[model samples]
Target: MIEVKNVSMSFRISQDRIQSIKEYLVALIKGKLKYKDFWALRDVSFSVHPGEVLGIIGHNGAGKSTVLKVISGILKPTSGSVSVHGNIVPMLELGSGFDFDLTGRENIFLNGAILGYSRKFLNEKYDDIVAFSELGEFIEMPIRNYSSGMLMRLAFSIATVVNPEILIVDEILAVGDESFQRKSRQRMMELMSGGTTVLFVSHSLEQIREMCDRVLWLDHGQVKMIGEAQEVCDAYQI
Candidate 1:
């Protein structure tokens, strides 16, 4: 189960960066360049059952990704609370925990370790991960040489290797090709069928409607509506 109550996140963003030492001194003295607080999420509350698939949808800067980040424990909410039960696998960013200097094969073990998986467990899943990623020859090469799509494939393959109890996914499916997206969708369906709780954030409304059991529509960091997939998505489309 996952519960997010009155979750709000605020960030202090610098308005502008001084280009040179002179500019910095002038700005510092004049207070021309300052920071402003931007609230990404505000008073958003929701819950997900053990086997439910919840889809979060909105436009750019709508706080859709903020909700997932809070749930994944990547970003702390400025206010309110987020509680998640069971093991979680978050596919929020591709190449986030990766080392560009390390080979894909080495990073697999490294990533598995980060995820609290034993060497034995990673060993058992190594071949499958490589196969699924379809980066056979390149898996032995440094990750710095990999393309964005290739990186997404590897990340998705590793993140989904284990059937986690809770899965939090952002718009990572947008990076891969059509074939890989289809493959990833199939894997997600398998996980959902296994009764895993899923929190998905995507701009693709069609995909959200097709895969999600329930949908939460967010606008400007606020919960606009939350209900059945069709109804919420229908309203969001407007």
Candidate 2:
């Protein structure tokens, strides 16, 4: 289960754009770095029980992603508390862990290790990951040469090879070509039904309504509504 209570997050961002490192350094030394408090999330609270699929919906910068980051332990709320039970696999910002200098083959181990997969586990699943990625001969090439779709495909394959008790996804189903997208959706459904708690954020209301058991709607960094998927989605559309 995931429990979040009275969560508020604040970031102090520079009011003026510093175009260069030298300018930033000068401003810092002169104590002239103008900053403003930006509240990304305000008193957001919710919970997802095991085997539940909870979808988060909001406009950009409405704190959908921020809430997920807090739950994944990627960011700390400036106030309040978050508790997550069981292992978590976060697919937010897919391919963010890659080394462009390395071959796809090499990064299977490199990126897998970053996700806390044991080397022995990667070794056993390496072939399966390669096949699922459909990279074929390109797996031997440096990742820098890969197209964006190819890169995301590899990342998705590596990340989804093992199912975790909790899955956090942010528009990840849009990763690849149409055929791969269908396959990815099927895989996601399997994971969801396998007793994994899923926290998903997507712009596709149709997809959300279809896959999610419940929806949380945020407007301006606060919970606007939380209810059945169809109910909240209907209100969000109107």
Which digits, one per residue and each the tens of the lDDT, describe model 1 over residues 1-238? Answer: 9989999999888778557999888888997878889999989999999999999888899998878878888899999999988989877775567989999999998887887678998999999999999999999999999998898899888888888889888866644899888998788778767888888888898889888999998999999999999999889887
Q: In candidate 2, which residue pairs get closer than 3 Å at backbone N, Cα or C atoms, i.e. clash?
A: none
lDDT of each: 0.87, 0.92
Q: Give the TM-score (vs. native) of candidate 1.
A: 0.87
Cα lDDT tens digits, model 2, 1-238, are: 9999999999988878889999999999999999999999999999998999999999999999999999999999999999999988888878777999999999999989888889899999999999999999999999999999999899999988887889999998866999999887888888887888999999999989999999999988999999999999999999
For model 1, the stretches where C-alpha displacement exceeds 4 angstroms are: 17-35, 174-178
Measured against the true structure, the TM-scores of the candidates, in listed sequence, are 0.87, 0.91
**After aligning candidate 1 to the native by TM-score, how far in Å is the CA of 76 from where it should be?**
1.6
How well does candidate 2 match the true structure in TM-score terms?
0.91
